[model samples]
Target: MTRETSEQPPEIAEVLARWQETWPTALQLWNPYVSLREPQWCLTTAEAREAGLQDSFAMIRLRGLAVVVDLETVRKLRVENYALQVLAHEIGHHLLVPANLYDYAGLMMRVRLALAGIEDRAPLVANLYADLLINDRLQRTMGQDMASLYRHLREKGIGETRIFLWYMRIYELLWSLPRGFLSCDKSEPVLDADASLGASVLRSFARDWLDGAGRFAMLAYPYLIEDALHQQALREFAHLSDITSAGVGAELPAGMAEIPSSVFDGIVDPREEVLQNAPNHQEADSPGRAKPGSLTAIIPGSDASTGPQQRYMQPGIYVDLMRQIHPDVDEDRLIGRYYRDVVTPHLVPFPVEALGELSGDVLPEGTDPWEPGDPIEDLDWFESALLSPIVIPGVTTRRRVYAEDIAEPEKEKPYHLYVGIDCSGSMHNPRRTFSWPVCAGALVSLSALRVGARVMACLSGEPGSFMETRGFIKEENEVLRVLTSYLGTGYAFGIPRLETEHLQNAKEKTHLLIVTDDDIFSMLAAPRSDGQTNYDIAEQALRRAGGGGTLVLHARAEWRPQEAERLRQMGWVIHYVTDENALFDFAKAFANRFYRSQGNPTCKRP
Candidate 1:
């Protein structure tokens, strides 16, 4: 492509050189990273596109590691009189807007929220919303000539498509441009009225672009859905959207330390290799900006060498995909109809708090705070060394000064959790759709693990068989596997299974939870493995684990009061759920009671 292209005109090259110089000076105050590593120059759109830019023109990518400029587009955009502004605008995508990988994913997800039907337009909408935010910052904050970029586009005789017009009108109003300055020539202005709302939305959230993005996407929804306007919007952003799709399908890049592969649901494009190798492929493709020294703190999955297949399987993603599988299915009903289906939105991805928030006391401050007579464990070396020189024989402050060691507080010890869910014929299979019950169970199980709790997950049905994690463990996938599996085998959860496995020969102090319905009455009345009644086995399980146990039943209040009474007598807490929505809340309340002191909180129940 580069070999086939004509050389960049001297005028365009000179202009790019100026922007290259201007970029460092402009962003120096906002982002020092630009100074350490400057944006690279791509002499043509082909070079820029080859250099990992999604669009044919200018772009900043690789988490601000490099900026790629298509001088050809820059050359044409200059006819509109603000080519450098576009350069700065691409730079803004990296340093600001959805600034980091997480924020970028957040932006994508937020757009997904507003786009239930027109998901094909997610990348495009996200890109446009991002442009508005970045341009607003440049025009309104730094006082750049952002409007000229649009004014020139308008001069090109392109009719203002709704999104394009909505976007331009934003700049016009924001900068006090004339009402009809960015005209569509159509009798009904495509985005005339909403521009005011867009302007207000921009001002109210000029600083918080991510939140502003949600509102902006909502504003663009009507235009997005109108068949003609939608096509026009798509045509207007064709290049950027193509790039977004290209990036979406692109290969994973090495040194992609900021965003995790899991966040991308496996697709990732790292520009480390591309930036290193870019100059070799094209004419005058310069080695781009310098990568910063440390980003392990900023970019997640810096060393994500291996893990279970993870995706952005948030509730919204789940709902979207499920619709693809059963296209005619009602998603709202799917979310609320079953127990496990509703839980997916609330379950945490991991079992343990990656932040390592095990609560513990701070060690007392003092060097050698412990003396010969004092407990040796309490000795503080630093404080004691300082005290020894000033030590006087009669002074009690100096005597015990070295007694207490200034110690880093240890985090709270995590507990073991045992989760048992009913998977009988009446219960819905989680594998079929979004499983709310399994999701609810996961909410508790992950919370338990986050706080350093070992969780034993079990799927149980009566008579034929049951599945268990066998013993306490911390693997989320293992626990989720049990929760997600379908076992529409028996009539009810086998009480005998819990008695023999968890209650009788428990390896650790475990918190037991049983999820079932009123049908569990038969299991409670049935004989256990020990020949004792089911109630007796559960009672013993509670006493042996020493930790409290809970029984959550999804049955009518009047049906199981008598049956639940026997378990309640055994000191097991009982919670009834009339609606599946309340199940997530209950799971969270239960987890907080058990795991709060040990780790950070997970997503709240809906």
Candidate 2:
């Protein structure tokens, strides 16, 4: 009998009512997957909230089918028609049983029994059978319903699932469903004949009940299934393998070797063609061949190749061509070398007791010298020596005749320190030794804090490489945290204006210290209409504090002498420190000069 005409079974009605009461939001969210003409199952927000039904679930039974939804989930959905989609998907599952009670019963029994054996050796066997069944039968059934669902949703300009095969391949099994019948004993297997017959009878009763439910789902929630299918298709497309061989001319470099076939297969885009030609084949094969002595074919010699030559292009030719085009490219440089050169040398070849001596006073007690979290005392003592600047008493000095009059204490201006660190992708190269920047930044920050200077630290790389302290003044740790957050990023967008926006607004003396590779000098020096180098920006900004502003340019030692001279001419204090160990000395000297000059104002003149 048709479900609409048949009396509503009380247990089936109760289950539907419970589903509605338990997860109204999930049901609503899945409405797009549901079909129209499916029976309406009423659920309230309070009931859904009580069950914590935030995620969606599809319920299938011999008697009927339904989708339960949480109320909060429905409210959060971007699409208002989610409820309709959910209902349609439930109907799709119900429609799988249409008029085939015996088949439906047998399928359900097998699925249920397979699910039960999942925890033991039988799990593998059960899973294999279930996978086969779902892939072959269930997917075909779902595909049929999906076609209708797709047409309905597509007509409305909703979403559609174009690559249904991808989903069919990945999601053949209902991974979420529990395997095995928990109520039955593990050792006892259900008799195949009895299960088949019983399932058929139960399915007949279920078919009548679901006929009403399925119609409601189909009528009310077509888009739910449609959108899900669309998403599934997109996911499958992302994972699809597109294998192609390397091009004919492609080859490994001379002295270099081919990548292992297995290794190459993992990352090689399947779409790329493999190279097969050998180098110098054409020239060797067409020896002594000459073209017609026409103006287009030959100019001076009146002889040139005019016809196709059959010669294998060796893979080495392409490798050589690539090497010429990108001579400086070295992939190995990208991986960190810090462990070999910096970390290893300092920690190894010496006893732990030697660490304290090597580190001097800075390394703290109770820390390992080799580990990252090792005690500072056993590592290096330079930081503690630098700390002396903060505690040293100010000494009075005789003013030189050319010295400007010292300002009164009341008028002593607070200094603004702007530190720009280059965190571009190139900075990540271990060959460049990036740890210097990190350590230098940390030391500079600590020193700035000790001197009561307001510090603004920034990392520049890509369009959004900036990371800075926001209204951050007090906590030194906070500033360090911001600095450490910088990731080596891709190409940076804007010019490195190290001096302008950061220091220009300060009423106090300004110190713009830029730590970067020499590569950035040209970008910083390109003339602005205002006739200002980045250094000029700082000079103008610090002029407000009675010319107390200074620019310090720290770059790699390999920078051209001309670059240093040009910066010096621009009135910047330039220093070249090639390696990390030297950076601490440079900072120490710079800090000494800065602090000592506070007492002897005319000690060093620009």
Candidate 3:
């Protein structure tokens, strides 16, 4: 659609004039990448639809780019100068404008053919076009004026040579802007009138080129313009090599022999003056002026004064807090906080058993058989109970107990716990409230280790690749260390190979605990054996392990009903806790169910 009436207001007229002058060139530049044509400036949804457009504003191409601007939307959204400029920039793309010398060459060729024979002065036109092209390229590449565009180009793939050429061209083109007016060394007849015409044409061309380029650059590189200053500040503090190496640097890579040595020498090396700037380096590395114990001091803060206070919240605090709330939260119990808040009340009414009762004695429920001579109350007995495996009902088969059960304890076999943790990109939310999987995994590992279960923590990502940590954990510090080292190994697209491999391994009764957001059921159930997913492989392993197979699915707030049901149907006893406090409750319930079957009277909910 045509621009708004010039009679509307002087400010409106000025804006339209500026837009008309700038948009043509910008559109031309963007045309090569995205085809743009006939832009309609709409004022309402009705107007946009009447003009065959679908969005408030969009670059649609029936044949070429058509930038549709909803005028009604502009008023409704209260779009100002910046927004107007952005809209005009999109229109500029429709105009197929050029921003650099190479691109302008094509534009010049088109213009020359269009205006042929009218201007007899071909040499002057050619020279003027060349100069303008160079100047525009230089301004775009090296001048601070188009630094935003340069930054965008840097993010893309523009080389150092192109940037340098852009700068050099700017200087040369500035000299050529007024060349027609200046007296030359080898002068021919000075056609003053023709020269003037040439100057006017060149000025018109330059103004349009610059405006279009600026507008298009802003739109094309929107994020760069907003982030340029911050990025510049970051560059100031960054290693020089990092900022300037190869594609980003002021010079080419080592093997590019065409680059001159003089040009190479200009490349700055912040590391060169290391000896003299040692103090400055140290100062830069020194902790900033943030006070200790403040919020700012905790993260992204100065380390010098804060000491280790903000390094990480003390593990002791976490352990003490867990212990105070759920006194039974020890090493061997799989404690989780998924549905703790919602399900703890439901679980509290049930009789929660302890570890000693599950493994040491076969006492009936509600019967206290502890005597003064009984060794169950001793710390060593509790420690041994913590390490021993308890046979939960429906989980393990009944086994024979030897004299070593109460006397010399049999050495526990380290069980290989293949923990498949979902660390896909979607799980990258670091906020405490959203980090249930990480927290739950940590607590579960701790519980397993405390109860003498040899735990192997594995993060499932990609296909077969998993970060697995084995060996018995003796303390909380070791557990945290392993957990902290677990980095997200990118997104997973298929069922993890571990699931299949775990099913294949027949030697040991492997307990595979999959801590995930329950999105893998479809993939896992693909090759169902008798309409069952490979979950039977896990169940069978647990059965082989005397019924100790455990599958714990830690869910987020938005639970998938079908997936949850499928997991439950697959024989996974789901412990759903909503907060950290409930993790202990879940652990206590789990311990009581499995650990107190032997009636040692030591089983109690913490």
Q: Which tens-of-lDDT digit does each residue in 385-494 have in candidate 1?
A: 56565644334223233123333443445557778898888777664434446767877887777656789888888777788885787786677777777788888888
What are the per-residue Cα lDDT tens digits for candidate 3 across 440-505?
555555544544455556666553345555433345444444443334555542343344443454
TM-score, predicted candidate 3 vs. hidden true structure: 0.29
Worst 10 contiguous positions by lDDT, candidate 1: 303-312
Model 1, 438: alpha-carbon shift in Å?
4.5
Q: Which one wins by TM-score: 1 or 2?
A: 1
Cα deviation in Å at residue 281, candidate 1? 64
What is residue 363's positional error in candidate 3, in angstroms? 28
- Among these predictions, the greatest TM-score belongs to 1
Per-residue accuracy of model 2 over 1-606 as CA lDDT, tens digit each = 001212332343444554444344333333445433333332444664343222232223222332334333333322222333344344434444321233332232222221221211111112222222222232243332322222232333332232222122222122221222111111112122222222232233233432222111111111123445435433432211110000112221221111112221121111111111444423222111111211232111212211011111112222232232223433232111111112221211111111111322242233112334444334333433343433322221111112223323322323455666667776643222234565455555555565455677666764445666653265665665555555576443124344444444555555666666665565556577766675455445445333343333345545567766666665566666655456555655555444323432222222
Q: What lDDT score belongs to each candidate, Candidate 1 first?
A: 0.59, 0.35, 0.36
Q: lDDT of candidate 1 vs native?
A: 0.59
Which rank order by lDDT, best down to worst? 1, 3, 2
Residue 424 in candidate 3, Cα distance off native in Å? 1.8
Stretches > 4 Å off in candidate 2:
1-414, 429-434, 462-464, 490-496, 499-502, 525-558, 595-606
